[model samples]
Target: MEINTFRESNQFTYSWHAIGAGLLASFVGFASTFTLIVQALINAGATQQQAATGLMAVSIAMGLAGILLSFKYRMPVSVAWSTPGAALLLGLGVVKGGFSTTTGALIMAAFMLTLAGLWKPLSRAINKIPSGIANAMLAGIILNLCVAPVHALAAYPLYIAPVLIVWLIMLKIKRMLAIPAAAITTLAVIYFTAKVGNIHAGDIMPHFILVKPEFTFSGFISIAVPLFIVTMASQNIPGMAVLSVNGYKPDAAPLFTSTGVSSLFAAPFGGPAIGLAAITAAICAGEEAGADPGKRYWAGIVCGVAYLFYGLAAGAATRFISISPPVLIEAVAGLALMGALGNSLMNALSDKENRDATVITFLITIGGHAFFGIGGAFWGLVAGLAMTFFLRQRQLKAA
Candidate 1:
């Protein structure tokens, strides 16, 4: 897809569908998980203001990064907050040195990601990880979220059924619109069932609040290392897979470096972490975005613009989510991610040679256990690859 062709095609003829896809994907990605992010920040000892600032920073950073990458490469590249990283924070529940120290850890993670992008040996090592295991790790990370709708329906049948029904109908009629339909249905249910006025909107306006970094040995060991590992193994690897499956071949190092730079700037502002988006990027990269791949970059641009606006409203949005029942929001997010989870599982299991290893990775990750301050994702990769290596060696000996 040439830039000239993008320019010549009716001035890019702006595929509104592409733009819509981007907008929905971004909205779902943010709305569904922002409460968890806020909770993670607060649990890390951040004030509410600081948490909101973090959300704004990551939203803006990802938006701008997505736009720049899309325009520069003419690919539907999207960036996002690291969901797995946030989950890691949730599990940490206030590090030894508090929020400032955690911020330092985020900066360190960003620096490590930047190095991974710039250093050949590191990048090659990352690339050498079996795709099956990487995909499995991501799948395990998201599997819980994907099943939320069912749990929601079981618990709040009347409240959740309508949304689930809409999502299923949309999935049958128009696959790309399924999640959007579910989101709309969820909103409608909330409007009728819950008092709109009760929804909090504390300080609706967005404002920046910086939390200076305070590095510590504990922060680095517990927070920084795990964040970097989860971001790389769970987000970036699958993100690259999304692009590859969509028929775009991009150099991974630059993308990693760029997101690291964005995260570096965002860290001081309370952002947990940022990375290439795997699930939402798939939304923008798919056929629903557009028939012509050349023009698909417009989807990412529109998504970026949407994210910028979302950031501006982060304060209000976070407040509203805080007021809403957590289960409902998780259900919406789960619905949005079902497609992605299914795809990841398929990819993880597709390679027979790596099936055993991938399954090991998936089970360990889904187990959601941590040891020695390291998250399951890291351990999952280690276990899976070790099994894979051992099995390969055994096969060679037998042959």
Candidate 2:
């Protein structure tokens, strides 16, 4: 009888932990990237309904996949929409064919991701990139998010100050609850300030919207190729590192394969490109989840459930944002990404040999410069490699 009772107790505890971790992970994960998704959809020429569909599709797929994978692995494996891909989509899809272009690119990218997973040689090559360089790249990619809060403060000093104070207090006092505190404080400040100013409220419910996808050759060339490159280099590479750092040795093939499949499934629905999320995954894998590493799986599960809820209320979410101050979002996202950005920078510049190349990569990436219709990441990497090769050739000649 006592053994049975203990088993039941253990199950309950696991379930609860998973739920809590999932919720925290999902909130932070989505909060970190959802705006970028909206921007991408908008750039892709999606209608309001289509945009909502994209958000919902992404939320559902990420949530379900994250939950299933975490549960299967018995570890936290949180998935997220690919922010870098979304940024690429915005630049490429928005100006060209819009929704059609975006969908076409998504399909193509998914295929490429699948191929990458299957091609052992290519995967191995990718894995061979110096860990320090990869870390640096990841940190550089996230640096903008950390800086955004300062931008937010500049924009709305009156409204953001109170929330920032609350966030700092929570950080110092109740560290685990810092994110939730920032969110709540931001919302409160927005509401009261808006009410006092008599600003009209935005719509709070997501509309039921559907966008049928159409594929095109041009779309594949312009959008798909770039999206594929960025997702692989910027998202998946860093995501794997996060898991590794946490002592979870996940098989890379399944992880990449799952993301590809999920992206394919989500394309028609309205979600921005879905991929592995490095930053949020780190949070789930951290020591705070529990003493037992296995218990962290619950965090992924919780994040999935939250995604579902967010998807269902997409319309309402838009409405809430309409009256809400932009500073609130900026501050929260910036604060959330601070640790990630710091970690990435430290890793990127750790080795003296790689420092110059990594700095070049970071500048090119953050500079937003593109070449031949491709985005910054591809060019940044190219420039870095070119410099590295040149230096190596010089050394050989001297020898």
lDDT of 1 by residue, 1-399 (tens): 322224454545678778888887787677656766776787688886788899999999999999999888888889999877876676566766689989999999988888888886876777788878877876777788678778888889999999888877988997766776776677678778776786554566789999989987767766777688768877887898898888888888899999989999899898978889887899898897988777788889989989899899878766655555667877876665566578779989997998999999999978867677555766787889999999999999999
Give the Cα lDDT of each candidate. Answer: 0.80, 0.68
Model 2, span 86-116: residue lDDT tens: 6555544464455765676677777777777
- Residue 260 lDDT, candidate 2, scale 0-100: 79
Model 1 residue runs over 4 Å out of place are: 1-48, 74-76, 84-102, 192-202, 212-230, 233-250, 278-296
TM-scores for every predicted model? 0.81, 0.78
Model 2 residue 249 CA deviation (Å) reads: 3.6
Cα RMSD, each candidate: 3.8, 5.1
